[model samples]
Target: MNWRKRFRTFWNRYASQVLRKILPRLESMAARLSSTDDTQELSEILATYKMSGFPLPMSFTDVDTVIENALSTGVHLTEAKNAEFALAVHIHPYPSNVLAVWVYVAVLSRKS
Candidate 1:
């Protein structure tokens, strides 16, 4: 096969494997976050995001940062109830830039 064909084959195989491994993990994590109370769930989600390689922004330490990042990045978030949030982000590379797509759904936590 030519180099282009070889590259394509390699990329497809790699992407498929990576997605298969990561998707289930992501789903499980999201489910866990979605099922709990607002504070606990948000904490877990932030921790997961940090552990998953997206470091928290140094300038802000509130849930707003998470929401903003999710929106700015083009993640696709679903419906949210009171004091809850959920979103998915996809990152892609371009020739001269990186694109982050975020979709966000969120509900503010009840203040004490």
Candidate 2:
């Protein structure tokens, strides 16, 4: 299998476990930042993830890649990329799941 498939398989199995550890830290960091510069802190978070052996995907390393991935997902994003971490809101167009809010956010990493 390709790296993407492998990564997806691994992610499907371990994402919850990893996210349980990651999300809280990120939330706290963001909350603490308030209004100051966030670049350094965000980079530090990514580095900490790397050091923890659960490094994030480097595919959306740039704005172009972020845009490309968003476009390729088949779901239309409500907003465009504007920062290192962009949340592509995917509200289902179908009537059945109209209320479903599926967020697809990619953290822009400096790796690769």
Candidate 3:
């Protein structure tokens, strides 16, 4: 595996143990500091939150296998005409871009 995957695997194995040992001490120290001072604590919290401005990119950049398995391995026509007929029959009955279409698919797919 590449360095990124290796790093992730290493982190998954040890990061939790490290955090578990350190988090309580950090919380106790924070509590002690805030109890002694209020305004300074609030400002520090706001500053930290601001400094931690969320990381960008919603998902991973490189994707190798987009799909692990198909919905079925059975017989079915795979063409634009087949899709056109299927959509015209089932989807037209439902509101476009709505949850009803998803619900219909989920329900219909499990019928067999």
Candidate 4:
């Protein structure tokens, strides 16, 4: 299966809330920032990220892929490449569920 679809499936299983709203907001925001200046976009993502609950069924590497995919503006995953790893946060909701979430912000550049 394609990575995008895999990401959606991963979200369905692990994401704390539905991404239908926030994702587009992020995409629009990312789209607005110049690809060369993904630092701004990465900062926005790190500053705004607030996911809670759900354990990761995947790895940090998988998460890096998700961040890269979700924020990508290209027509396909192959059409974009991560230019930088700005930040990565691993959240473990304490006490009960022990949910592990890997949150990250990345800079993506259009493929040449």
What's the best-to-worst order under lDDT? Answer: 2, 4, 1, 3
55: Cα error in model 2, Å: 13
User: What is the lDDT for 38 in model 3?
Assistant: 31
TM-score of 3: 0.20
Q: lDDT of each model, Cα atoms only?
A: 0.33, 0.36, 0.22, 0.35
Lowest summed lDDT over 10 consecutive residues: which window, candidate 1?
3-12
After best superposition, candidate 1 residue 36: deviation in angstroms?
31
- Residue 9 in candidate 1, Cα distance off native in Å: 44
Question: Per-residue error at 70 for model 2, in Å?
Answer: 11
TM-score of 4: 0.24
Candidate 4 lDDT by residue in tens digits, 13-111: 122232222333433344464233343433443454432221122233345575564455333333222322222344434355553344433333323
How many angstroms is residue 41 displaced in model 1 relative to the true structure, after the best TM-score fit?
22
Kindly list the per-residue Cα lDDT of model 3 for residues 15-91, writing each as its tens digit.
Answer: 22322333333334434633332344324334422211110111122222211111121112222121110110011
Candidate 3 lDDT: 0.22
